[model samples]
Target: MGFEEDALLAESGLIIAPDPESARLTRTITGTDQTGAARDIRIVEERPLTIFLNSREIVTTMTIGDFPDYLALGFLKNQGMLRPGENVTAIDYDDELETIVVRTDQPTDFEEKLAKKTRTSGCAVGTVFGDMMEGLEGLTLPATPVRTSWLYALARTINTMPSLYLEAGAIHGTVLCREDRPLVYMEDVGRHNAVDKVAGYMVATGTDAADKILYTTGRLTSEMVIKTALMGIPVLASRSGFTAWGVEIARDVGLTLIGRMRGERFMCVSGEERLVRDADPAAVAAEDPRSRRKGSRD
Candidate 1:
């Protein structure tokens, strides 16, 4: 189905831009099945993207190779290296070298910050510096209410979209939504990478965060909670479960965390004060049967 412009604008009041298409998102490979049958399968392509801030090498991430520029910007943003409204002069990417260098007008020194790297629970290996949560204390999210009707519509639209996760088996999806409409959707090998891509996209487009919702296919971990909170997004929903630390941080930060969200069913572990039960539970249909994936039952 086409992304109706007026409906999206009315529902979310945001620019529903199309995800940049990439030719290298997937590749076909011949593989043998358990029955010894040779079949061609389309597999997602992952490449190492090493990010450099000016002259210093920052971090390397494995991603689906689509939107490397956004991935680089978002990675630095979430890592607390790139501050909000930081002036970026140039972002140079070398496909052959598998590296991206972000240049800014101001000098960036993170010798002490990088020294305190801590591993996170996100898949494909996630890391956070000691001061990553330093600015979260000052973050203030708007008291926007989330409607049950919006939740149902948002899930249905995201599930119907053609995504790398649905095409290939091993991928995670993160979507930026405004109530019932999804504005930007991104997928990557790691859930953190996907969220970073979305963060970068929002920064690039100057999207407002006050009334936005963040959706993910991965579980809610502390990293996920922190990243969403850093983005200044109040509402975060996941089709998967949540970790103990994730809920703790969400509660501490007052982020509206919703997990195990399948169709009409959802568990709001925190920030239930922001949920508006606008839709009648009986009127909402069960999750689309075709939308069921590996973690749909979770």
Candidate 2:
């Protein structure tokens, strides 16, 4: 490997990184290219995962089959079905049936909440049940000051990390980072699923989000903003662009929202006051062309 690859490998010592080589996560298929030459390419595998809270069957999500436990807990937590500090007695996953059941100590019911499902703009058609906005009524993220040096370091490290998105064309990634180090990296067909996995990991491991930053390889939408704020994460940065409501909500909740983070450039649309501009942008190395992922050009 070259010096750049070696540096990338050294920086990608995440607690949970992508497993692109997993046979269950990808499939090879033959197809013809532009020149009509035969080619075999690997594509990500999407499977239906039905999540149940107690006896109540929640929404069925299409995801890249991995980390079903985290996905389930995160989904329910984000949807307001699982409140914080709720006693989760057991979490059972039956891969053969493609189902995961989360049992809580208290009896649970969300029949009416499930009836008011709102379809989000996330890929694979993400659904939010029962007033996702209500969760933000009294929500305020910590005014955590983020250093520009940390942001630059995180962007360079995460962009060059080996991931399923670099392996397959269709995927989104969300990384949980502290300062300049990436901790858990999760990818899925939908960006929502990826974020949920990160959230689940936080909940499962009891990791605090107040001092952390979230990096995504997806657009900054309202759903993304809400989830990050609800998780109590102060900063959300993306290599892509943003939506109007996403910026508005981030500003309202004191959450730092930075987007269009490529190479030595980044735009902080919300919580700009929290950023300590300690890094000289000109001194930072430009993003390597070969490290660019899918949809980065958009």
Local distance difference test values of all predictions, in order: 0.82, 0.87
TM-score, one value per model: 0.90, 0.94
lDDT of 1 by residue, 1-298 (tens): 2214433453454533324244478778999999999999777888899999999998888888877777888888888888756788888988999999999987889999988988888899998876657777856667779998998888877877777666666888888888787878778889999899888876665668888999999999888999999988999998999999999889888899998878778899999999999998788778768666445866
Runs of candidate 2 with Cα error greater than 4 angstroms are 1-13
Please give the lDDT score at residue 84 for candidate 1: 57
**Best candidate according to lDDT:** 2
Predicted candidate 2 versus true structure: per-residue lDDT over 47-164, tens digit per residue = 9999999998887899998989889989988888887568888899999999999999878877888889889988777889988696899788899999999999998888888888
Candidate 2 has its poorest 10 consecutive residues by lDDT at: 1-10
